[model samples]
Target: MSTHSYDAIVVGARCAGAPIAMLLARAGANVLLVDKATFPSDTMSTHLVHPPGVAALRRWGLLERLEQTGCPAVERYSFDFGPVTIAGTPRPIDGAARAYCPRRTVLDALLVAAAVEAGAELREGFTVEEVVADGGRVTGIRGHARHGSSVTEHAPLVVGADGRHSAVVKAVRPGQYDERPSRTAMYYAYWSELPVDGFETGIRGERHRGWAAARTHDGLTVMPFGWPIEEFHANRHDIEGHFLAMMDLAGDLGERVRAATRESRFVGTSELPGYFRTPYGPGWALAGDAGYHKNPITAMGINDAFRDAELVAGAVADALSGTRPLDDGLRDYQRIRDEEVRPIYELTDAFARLDPPPPEMQRLIGAMHGNQEAMDAFVSVQASTLPAPELFSPDNVARIMREAGADG
Candidate 1:
């Protein structure tokens, strides 16, 4: 077997891995980024990146590249809860008030190019066969390119950005906490000639159904419909039928969608499980869905991946550059990551259940209707630019109720 060495090795070169490798190489670290899939490949994703994620791209100097791809910026978010539709703009985060739903083929390639440009070595189509360890410390990886002989690469650090079913995670056997079973199943398709003004989400509380639509690259719209996990089996057999029927619950969206042409096959999953894994060990670390995963109902996957990429990259750089101990740096990364995502994790778990909102939440949503400020705050909460607690605080909720002339 061939042997090589680097300062760090990153697995799964998509959203999380590419950014982590890019940032580390930018920090002057010798990094190796490997992925089983070649660039421009599509993956299943909600594809929505909120304002904070947009800010991350801007910081990385890739926002303009994304814009040049003809992906539309979603400046408004509308939540249709059957009885009331609350539409408003989320508050800006770092001068980014808009979201984008770029196709994964475009976005992931952009990221991989950035990583390569930053001097990270890329091994496309490399599949990891083993995460090698020595004395309980991750030492390197054994993998090979498609149609090639297996080779070994050693590094002080091995990072897994390999998604929920991470090979590295399986090898390291990191402890997981707050584990929950799948709560919802979702299916989506891309359609041509179906234009949406911005991001639109609909909830049919009575039917325990939800759907969302957003305009993406090539002027196509991507729409997803979801149901409780209990119904996943029944619905999987007739995805088109159930999808169209759910769209019918969203007013005229069904009519508009019917008038459009489907440009892609239906894609979906019912395996979403909410949990956070212990992200770091002696010489290994996790980033993105490899460490934390939750339902895509809130559309937070891409955004959170961007955020954690920066965090893990910074942590690894600090450690490798002798700014701190590796364990300390990774520990800090774990703590901060957990603290940052706990709120949204809880919110996503609850929403994924497709249960009707509690009386208080229903009342709060009702009070926000027709009230621009309150609705904006609500949207901000959904975008994760503002904390949910801030908007749902007793004082804020009461003030909104009073201003909207709704009974408390």
Candidate 2:
């Protein structure tokens, strides 16, 4: 055990942990941020960040640093649904109007750096072995370093900002709900000199298969994903062949892939079950994918992490400052995150199933082909600036129809 004590001890210092620690430390809390991995390391991810995430980085004053790394800012988004295409610029979020797809190596390091700059103590390569609890309340964490002996750190509040398979959540075992089976297997890789013309695109091909393309860190990325869960085991052995075959779903994207040089080996996952866990307990809390995860088909994970970090940071800061009881503030954090994420989670789950939408839904999407405002609003929902209902409600559809009729 160690003698040091902090206002907060945050585990898994990436998108979620770093931001939470940075915000709390910025508010005059002594925060300790720990992560198993070192800075500038790669992690599995789609790497896409929508406009709202861009806004969060701007709020933290890190967006300019991210831009300094030369990660391109994607200004346009296009979705192809075989019969029609909806294309538009992303809607602005807090005066920011662009998306990004920087590699994890670039993004995570930046976030960690920001946390350190904000006066948070970061302990990289420290793996948490257990959660130390006393009188039914989490008191701290016990872990060892990559090379040093075992150690322990004390704190009133412990946060798990780890990814979906968080050790903190596993130890605390908070209430979990909305559990669902995996819907699709995903596979993607990078290519050099893939011509994208400065746009990010999502293509829905035959059989409802989904494809995504964007320019990131060093190359263009192409992900051909969404085969049903049942095919996972049988297809694991021939991932490259299956990946190439799936590329045929988008002929244009497929042709580009065939022409471009492969810059990295294919990587992917067949298991991504979605769920929501209670965010807090007596003295512990969860943030980012540790508390909730949705299908990546929507490319919302990074943005969700940013938002979660901000929420958890604010609530924890209030609790630590004695403005509110920790449990009450943490519970409010859970409620707010649920209300914000539930809609997109459901929509992403449905899309991940790779099934055709109902006829009415199809009509609504088809209508977006001609309505630029509606199309842009729909994209904004994906970016998380606007709520889902604003673009999907019956009243909204009627309004779009009336406007279209007037234009005609």
- Candidate with top lDDT is 1
Candidate 2 per-residue lDDT, tens place, 1-408, comes to: 677879999999988999999999999999999999999788887688888999999999999999999898888777777777777776797988798988889999999999999999999999998998999999999998899888989998899998898888988999999988888888778888787744445545346567778888765664536577778898888977877776676667778878888877878887789999998987799999999987788888888889889888888788777898777778888898889888898888888887777677777777677889988887777767788977888889878767767323
Runs off by more than 4 Å, candidate 2: 197-199, 203-206, 222-224, 402-408
Q: Which stretches of model 1 miss by more than 4 angstroms? A: 1-3
Q: Least accurate stretch of 10 residues (summed lDDT) in model 1?
A: 1-10
Weakest 10 consecutive residues, lDDT, candidate 2?
Answer: 197-206
Clashing pairs in 2: none
What tens digits encode model 1's per-residue C-alpha lDDT throughout 1-408?
A: 545669999999988999999999999999999999999889988699999999999999999999999989999999998889899999998999999999999999999999999999999999999999999999999998999998889998999999988999999999999998998888889999997868999888779999999999887899987999899888888998888888778787778898999998889999999999999998899999999999999999888889889988998888877898878878888898888888888888888888788888898888889999988998898888998878878888889989978864
TM-score of model 1 relative to the true fold?
A: 0.98
Predicted structure 2, TM vs. truth = 0.96
* lDDT values for all models: 0.90, 0.84
Clashes of 2: 0
